[model samples]
Target: MKLADKHTPTKEVKYGKALGGFVVAVNISMLLCLVTENLFSYGAAFVSLVGTLALFFDVMITLQFILLVLEIWSRFSRLNAALQDALYPHCTELFVGASPSYRCSLLQLQKTYVALGRAADHLMSHFGLPMAFDIAFCICGATCSSYEVLVKLLSDSDVPGLSIGMPVSISEVWLALHWLRILLLSLSCAAVEDTAAATGVILIRASVVPQRRTAEFDEFLRFTLHGPRTSFSAAGFVKIDRRLIVSALTVVVTYLIILGQLTFK
Candidate 1:
């Protein structure tokens, strides 16, 4: 297809806009709250501005990454749709292996699938450094935010000056947003593999239900058997799957425990 004929999805664009607007509004609101609390002191104003800028940039990068993930997922979804459409007519038991055209079509689709898998891995590789930093940012931020929340709730101190510049409500939102972003990142990355698995299912269904044993399908099965290796990962060090979210939250919890012990002791 021509580049012009392929258009960006309108719904995704609207979603991107909504996310960007929300991030901007939240950052601005947080900064305003900080500035108000500090009585607009010059030093606090400078610090809030710097912090807001850094936060805004960080969230924007994450948002862009999410949008990219959604786009890739859409492509994989379209691949599934294409598979169904292309093979529906030829997917009968006795006729599937007899058609030369079916084999050709399957070969083409296998190429598309392989290309998408490699592209997803390459995209992950490209973002590896940023992902490591982003996860680290989330880990530290979540730890502090959770600590603030716990201090507000569990501590016996009634002093207003105990907060580390952030209100408990803001800390709650901060903690939720950080995890939500990371969770979305992990789920979206993992969806690529899930969608790829759906393709495998389509092929396997053909073989299982109709018994279409062909050379092309065997080749395709061979590739799918190795699909997990091509899944998105963090510079080949760690996978960007549901487990990553679990691991990240585990780290946050461990630190939260340590901080609680030290503070409460």
Candidate 2:
């Protein structure tokens, strides 16, 4: 099947765009707050303002890339759904005859799956580095921000400027946002992995059906099983799945603990 034949659902595209836009807007607001607070301080911190602006632009670019990644995953999922529908149509007897047309449909679905996997691989090749950077930045940002807040609380320092409250400071908010973004990214990648794996399972189940059991069906099944497995990884280092979020959180906590120790000393 041609690449143009597959189409992403309009609703999914719209939702992804809207969510990305909202995240970017919130991040911009946070960065603007930081900049404004710094500007109005005792001494004009032009250096800090430059850093804040750099962060602002960096976040904007990262969010835009994330939006693209999400759209690609969304389209992959939609293609997988279409493949599933092809394998199992509304009528139970759709594949009962095991005709040549049914076999062709299966082949087409397999081709589509391969195309989707290639698209995923292409995306990983191009965006994997940036995504790894995003994850590292989030982990470091969350850890450092949390550490600063903890140090402030422990020292009983004057809560001046943006660091006003004890429970909900600007740093805490920044940490929360970083963590949220990490969680969302992990979940989205895991979802794509799960969907692709499910496609294989569905094919296997379809091939085992008594009515659908045929040489052609078995051939298609073997072809699918032998093909490259679909998964999302970060710069070929680690696979992104549900466990990723937990592992990332563990790293963040460990770094925070180390930072705490160093600060206390």
Candidate 3:
């Protein structure tokens, strides 16, 4: 996909590796914390082992989805940056104008971007349900724990007693950590769309030669803006944030339904 002479994308590659490693570390830390909590609270190694395995499964499920999203994002960013560096400021690569290699590069990039969009949709289709439930569990745990602490504090009505069974500060910190996790997850998902859309803008400038441009350049730019899969939203309806909200509501409704059934029984 090289139209102009340039060095390898070592920087972006390094960044992706670093970010991936960081995500793995953070998630593994979370898994270990859960396993440790269960071990101490239950005093049963088998129970903790089972719970650890379950959590580790969920972690892998969600982690793979997240890693794919990051990969798509990094690719889009790399594409845009390469386009800019090749044809920006002085528009130096204007001589490559109408060349087959240049056109082929653009065509290949467009195809790759479309493939990315399809992959995004597939990711949503394959892992979306599990991820939604996994996140819902986190939110539910945070909400329930906070409610328990508040209720107990109100009943005891004293700082020392409130801090006895559950350390008040630690509880607050734990709740805050989950909330932060949710926030970061949402933001990272959003960046996919942002980076994907920027590709078209870069192409418009990179492909054009001031006042002179070819049909292929125009077509690619137009395709970018109006293509079926311009970005993460191939259907224009697969927004992660919206899905997360729907997932949250589903979780709440199911909880209520179970409570109702149990009370009636």
Candidate 4:
């Protein structure tokens, strides 16, 4: 599909707008609370306000990453649908001399698959740098957030004081949200990768139908089998999949443990 045709941008746009609005409102409300508390006690809420602002940006980036995943998922779904239609054409006839309509449908499917691939590539290129930044941000955020939660639970004194004007529970909730975002991002990447791989399998299956084994079929099979496959990576270091979640958790836990040791010392 052409760029214009690819981006319907109705539902996704609305979702992004809604998320941005909500984040802004939350940040503003927290800032107001912090200001009120600071007025009562000079310099008491400064650290908490700064931490809240950092969290606001972190959450905003996470939400934007989620939106990118949604867009990628939608594109992959469209590609899969086109592949399915190509595999099983509407015409009931299965003989070598299929109807002209079937031929046209197959041609259209080929064009669609190519267009979809280009669109996916464009999206990846556009989001590549941002994704790298997000990965780094998430790793650091996860480490700090996890360590803070651990300290809160173990220490008698609340030295960090992350929740100055807000309830103490909010700090725990924020950490949970950070972890949840990481998990969802990993799952979304895996889903998109699987969907693209499924198209390749479907093409291979379609190519093997004994009733439809022709030179053209062989050529299309060869083309598809040799084409570029879809995959996702994080900052060029690790692939994004279910395994990534486990790996990220491991890193977070290791950091938390190291921090705990230092704190005790």
Candidate 5:
């Protein structure tokens, strides 16, 4: 692919719509959480309603992703076509204005488009759609751990002088951690903003001027958002925060092992 163009009309409109839809989905999800706040008080009736609604929201999230895939696919095709066209006649002088890999940068972004496309496809299947489940499971575990810690803190045998237990409820801890988890998830929107910014810059560049020199530089900037793959190796993982995942795993494993031993013993 040529890897050098600043604007894509189809891509811009499609992704713009995807971003809007995702915003709506997130708002709806938050609303569901708010509505269920009083559910625990109602006991089984509340539980039944909340559980069914949760499943429905999960399905809706899946649909949001399907739309996302379509949006990305439309952009990727436009990019591929544009780049392939650009690569031929100007092959020799193409990236000469900038560094060679500067030209390769567009190719790299194309690769990212392909990678995300595949990931989206896998997400539509049975096994790959569990990212939401992972989010849910982590929230559940964190809530339970917080509640257990709160209980132990209040018990005289475990920690003296903290026995104001009557006022505390398990749901309070659950709600607090649930809110925090969602707040953290919102940070990922920062990534979307970066994507939007890059899309805007490139599209403007492509539409107004398709000149070789500036286009190369624009392509270079576009590829900055696509980090390298193969994150297991030393240099490969440098940009990624592997420690966060490692620490999370350590906590979950230690908690599970201790809980199991204490239960059986």
Candidate 6:
């Protein structure tokens, strides 16, 4: 699709406005939940109490994941384009020996790619596992809460020997499977990034020093340059914007911590 058709200015404005509104709503909901849970904990109805808590935690986690993915994807795509532009013949370094900026830019791009790959790795290792656990926990919590409601209703029917300590439900298993799907998606991303990082580093080192160091540089370059795969053909590391990565991950971790306080305690 054409760029204009894909991302019109008006569409961007609409999305930005919607995002701001969503953030406001999220903050308001969190504050309200905190206040209600504390001040009128006893007065709140069971359904409202359980549903609101579930929703609050789920939304926070979902938002954090979405924001992180968007941030990484957008920045990575930009860096990819920048590298493509830099590699063009017209974008020559005027003073190859003295051009620190040229080398720095290339290195910076490579570093960003590495950062993206690292972030992807973290997502696969740490966040992915936690997300799976969280999904299971939330599902189990919901099932137990539902059983509590059901048991309470049944107790009022004058049943004599229908006593169960807690209901065992299979919702957690369902959620665990869902979490597995998400993990698989992230795992695919991680594998791609791992390959990119490994190959990029080798290529970047070879590109930097062809004759002075590394006997295999020539052979490596020849293979990489002529490789059928587009990704392996590239010379530099993936360029990621550190500021964006840090900011996104910070937001994610912060929200997760806040969510923990709001939920577990």
Model 5 compared with the native: what TM-score?
0.33
Ranking by TM-score: 1, 2, 3, 4, 6, 5
Winner of 1 and 2 under lDDT:
1
How many Å off is the CA of 149 in candidate 4? Answer: 1.3
Candidate 4 least-lDDT 10 residues: 4-13
**Candidate 6 per-residue C-alpha lDDT over 19-126 given as tens digits, one digit per residue, 9 for 90 to 100:** 545544754554454435443434457766676676567556645654554444444555545544444432244334324444555555545554665565554444
Summarize candidate 3's per-residue lDDT along 1-265 as a digit string, tens digits.
1221122243364477888888878877766665556566666788778877876786677777777778767776776675565345446554554566555655555566666677677777776667667576667866655655564565576434233365454455455545545554565677777777787777765554753265656776887888864233212333455455455546645765664354336
Q: Residue 167's C-alpha lDDT in candidate 6?
A: 26
**For model 4, which pairs clash?**
none
Cα RMSD (Å) between model 3 and the true structure? 6.1
Model 6: ten consecutive residues of lowest lDDT: 230-239
lDDT tens per residue, model 1, 1-265: 1111132112243354565466457645654564454444345667767766677677777777766776667666666776676667665555435478767767777777777777777677678878778877877888988999988875447744344555566777777767877787788788767987888888767666454567887788777776554467666666789998889889999998999778756
Candidate 3 Cα deviation (angstroms), residue 165? 6.2
TM-score of each prediction: 0.78, 0.77, 0.72, 0.70, 0.33, 0.38
Which sections of candidate 4 miss by over 4 Å? Answer: 1-62, 89-96, 156-168, 214-216
- Give the worst 10-residue stretch by lDDT in candidate 2: 159-168
Residue 66 in model 2: lDDT: 60
lDDT (10s digit) by residue, model 5, range 129-239: 354553555546564555465555546465444444323444454445444344333333223333434543554444333445455445544453453321111122222
Ordered from best to worst lDDT, the candidate numbers read 1, 2, 4, 3, 5, 6
lDDT of 2: 0.68
Best by lDDT: 1
Of the two candidates 1 and 3, the one with more favorable TM-score, higher being better, is: 1
Root-mean-square deviation per candidate: 4.7, 4.4, 6.1, 5.9, 13.7, 14.2
Best of the two (4, 6) by lDDT: 4
Clashing pairs in 3: none
Worst 10 residues of 3 by lDDT: 1-10
